[model samples]
Target: MISTDNFTIDSTKSKAAAAERFINLRQQKKVKEFLVKQRGYKRPDFNRMILDLSRLKWTHEKIAFVLPVAGASTVSELARGGIPNFEHGEALIELWKSETRVDRVPREGEWQTYKYEIGQLELL
Candidate 1:
C-alpha cells in the first residue's frame, strides 16, 4: 500500500513538472512573437523625432541636457534640419524610443495636467 501511494505521488509530481514546462515554453513562444512584431517597426527620422519631442513640450536645452551632443545649440541646429553625427543620431533615437512608449504621450494641453498629477503623487 505504501509503495502504491509513493507511486501515485511521483506520478502527480511528474505531471506537475510537465505542466510547468509546457507553460514556460508557451511563454517563450509568446515573447518571440512579440519581438518579431517589434522588429517590423521602423524608427522615425531624426527630423521627425525632434518635431515629435517638441510637440511633447520638450525644449532644445532639455534635450541637450539628456543627449551626449555638444550643447543646446547643436540640438537647435538638428531641429532646424541639420544632420547629426552617427553617435548623436543614435542617442536621439534611443531617447525618442524611451520617451514615446505607446499611450504615454499626452495631447497638447494634457502634459501640464499630467505633470501636476505626477508631482502631487510624488509629494506623498
Candidate 2:
C-alpha cells in the first residue's frame, strides 16, 4: 500500500510546477491569436516609438485619443518598456509619420538608441 504521509515535498519541483501553471493562465489572457499573428511587434521597435514621441512632446492624452490601447496611467510604463497592444503601435506609427513627415518605422539596425554609454566613464 502507498502511504501518503511518506512523501516529502520538493521545493524546486513545486516552484517549477507553480511557474508553469502561472504561465498557462497568463497565456489565456493574451490578445487574440489571429490578431497577434497579423499585427505583433518587436519590443525594441515599440520602445523607440515611445521615446521619439515623448521627445516630440506627444502626450498620452493625444495617443489615447487616437487609440484606446495607450492610457494615461501606462505612459511611463510603455515609455520605459513598450506598449504591448498592436493597435497602439499602429496609431502611434501614423502620428509619428504625420508629425515628423517621415514615412518609416525604425529598422532593427536603426533602432540603436545610444552610441555611447555614460556609465562606461569613471565617476569624477
TM-score of each: 0.45, 0.45
Q: Give candidate 2 misplaced runs (Cα > 4 Å).
A: 1-44, 112-124
TM-score for candidate 2, please give it.
0.45
Q: What is candidate 2's lDDT per residue for 14-110, written digit by digit as tens?
A: 7899999999977876756756775755343555665566566777766666655636656556666644567666776777666555555663445
Q: Which ranges of candidate 1 are over 4 A from the true structure?
A: 1-44, 102-124
Per-residue lDDT for 74 in model 1? Answer: 97
lDDT tens string, model 1, 1-124? 1257346356677789999999999999999999999876643346656766776778889999999988989998887768788889878877876766533433333433543123123210
